[model samples]
Target: MRSDYKELDNEKIYLVTGAAGFIGFHLSKRLLDEGCHVIGIDNLNDYYDVNLKKARLEIINKYDKFKFFKIDLQDKEFLEEIFKEHKIDIVVNLAAQAGVRYSITNPDVYIQSNIVGFLNILEVCRHYKVEHLVYASSSSVYGMNEVMPFSVHHNVDHPISLYAATKKSNELMAHTYSHLYNLPTTGLRFFTVYGPWGRPDMALFLFTDAIMNDKPIKVFNHGKMKRDFTYIDDIVEGIVRLLNNPPKENKEWDKIKADPGTSSAPYKIYNIGNNKPVELMEYIQTIEKHLGKEAKKEYLPLQDGDVPMTYADVDDLIDDVGFKPDTSINEGISKFVEWYKEYYEV
Candidate 1:
């Protein structure tokens, strides 16, 4: 039997920056499966385990359609070469210096990747006239908002961390390109995304590893935090759905009564989250249930550059993309646990 994917138009190339990272790796593999010609770029920085990133690349290299570049997004000249080579239809900028805590320690990496690197992407897209540019934003952008389920319309002026500020900056930069150059752009504010091939720095991964090794897991904020943990597969689904239907100018958009989600320009922002907040302790308990071992938890106050919780209102993503994240924490964690045991031969 044939797969659901049809052969892609060899004429069209899609550029996915940060191709080796968690989200980028998943997106690139999905595009390749659909027979899309994907041009993946990543610096392959050691911010996490390089072996894990290489593992992801190994899976993608199996598909004949993918071509990867070891180029950094900060390289402007290299950016020009790529834009000139492929008739790139879409650009998904997933590459960034991730981690809020790390951002506090090393601010330069954030500036280099998030600021300088993103600027390069914007310029490349603008100059080459790419049809669509979709970049990853984060729920951390909802910093200091007292709202339970954070809405996109709410003002995001008070960013709690440098990482959140950069994500917010990305949205603003994307909008500028959309507004000025007529670039169709969509910024995705991904919630606490966790699943197979997930980042090692994330809480779930860290907690699981520590428990198995009989090490104490750092329970931050005294285990009082909550997060709308959207599974990675759900995030990819929302992204692909939106990719098929790019954002367009809202004809009915009014200047005075502006909806922050949509704009007069061909720009949009959506919260791709589970829309259900999971408490920290409950999440750990679920992990413990899967591993059959109680975690040695060391309670700590909320670290700087961290928020108490993150809960996204995914109403816009559902209304626009026609679907929202539906994976329950139990199901998601089970899958992750299974993958963990198999991947590590535990």
Candidate 2:
């Protein structure tokens, strides 16, 4: 275990953008549970169900240490005011216009939220002198790569979707800030995260809802795809472990090799994944087993922006955080089914 996994001081405040989103909600709740003050910000956009976002906020609002703001990251003046009002020690940027397919028709939202919004965040972090800035990068950034287990060290210059491109751009932007302003930045490239309180658009939730309603579930790539389906709890655990352990200048970094994951400045990137890929068919089967109903399948060709597989190389994550996501598909799916049933009252 890392020695830095000590109790977080309540005096230190954390700013979590997209606090009502899937991962952000869980992360903010965890910090509040740890007796730390957390400033939560989210626009609660209609990209997903607004009620779902409100439901997540309802849970976090129970905690006295949690404060929420309904604001967009692109609004620099409002964001600046929030930073000036609160002494934020850490900033976790998780707000973004998510989804590969949506970006096809709604390209503008991605640029607005992922690009402009992120620039606003970088500026705020730079001005505020935040101890550490951890932002969400996606496995989608590993676009067009045939590698089995995607590593941060690999070149990710090719992206098939705008969403992926924006995420990659965030890394580049972060590196520039780190180099010029001496800000410590860490970007987490999360794999296919799923579990209780998951997004409605994700495979697990969609499969469960369709299967329960006797609707046909779209099986992309003819069910031959594979993904490192990480659980939300595990993803949150990795982020919490890294809250205090900011990146430092890698003295041994060489410009000759041009490694993509680390920099001479205080900038680093790591893939937070299960490190074990599961076939799409097998994953669906597990969900079916828990739901006690098989899904009506509509096998479809690979979507334009979709990849056939995604496998995360989390060796560096294990070495640095001393933890790995090991939740079995069976257990994780079962828990989701339980939550789905109770939440929807199915």
lDDT of each: 0.89, 0.93
| lDDT (C-alpha) at residue 95 in model 2 | 96
- Tens-digit lDDT string for candidate 2 (16-105): 999999999999999998899999999999988999999999999999989999999989999999999998999999999999999998
- TM-score for all models, in order of appearance: 0.95, 0.98
Off by over 4 Å in 1: 1-11
- In candidate 1, the residue pairs with backbone N, CA or C atoms under 3 Å apart (3 or more residues apart, or in different chains) clash, namely none
Q: How much is the lDDT of residue 35 in candidate 2?
A: 90
Q: Per-residue CA lDDT of candidate 1, range 1-346, in tens? A: 1122223344567889989999999988888877788999999999999999999888997888899889988899998998898888988999999999999989989999998999999999999989889999999998899888899888888999999999999999888889999999999999999998899999889999999999999999999998899999999888887774667888999899777778999999989999899999999999999999999989999999788988889888766656779999899999989988889999
TM-score of 2: 0.98
What's the CA error at residue 117 for candidate 2, in Å?
0.2
How much does each candidate deviate from the true structure in C-alpha RMSD? 3.5, 1.2
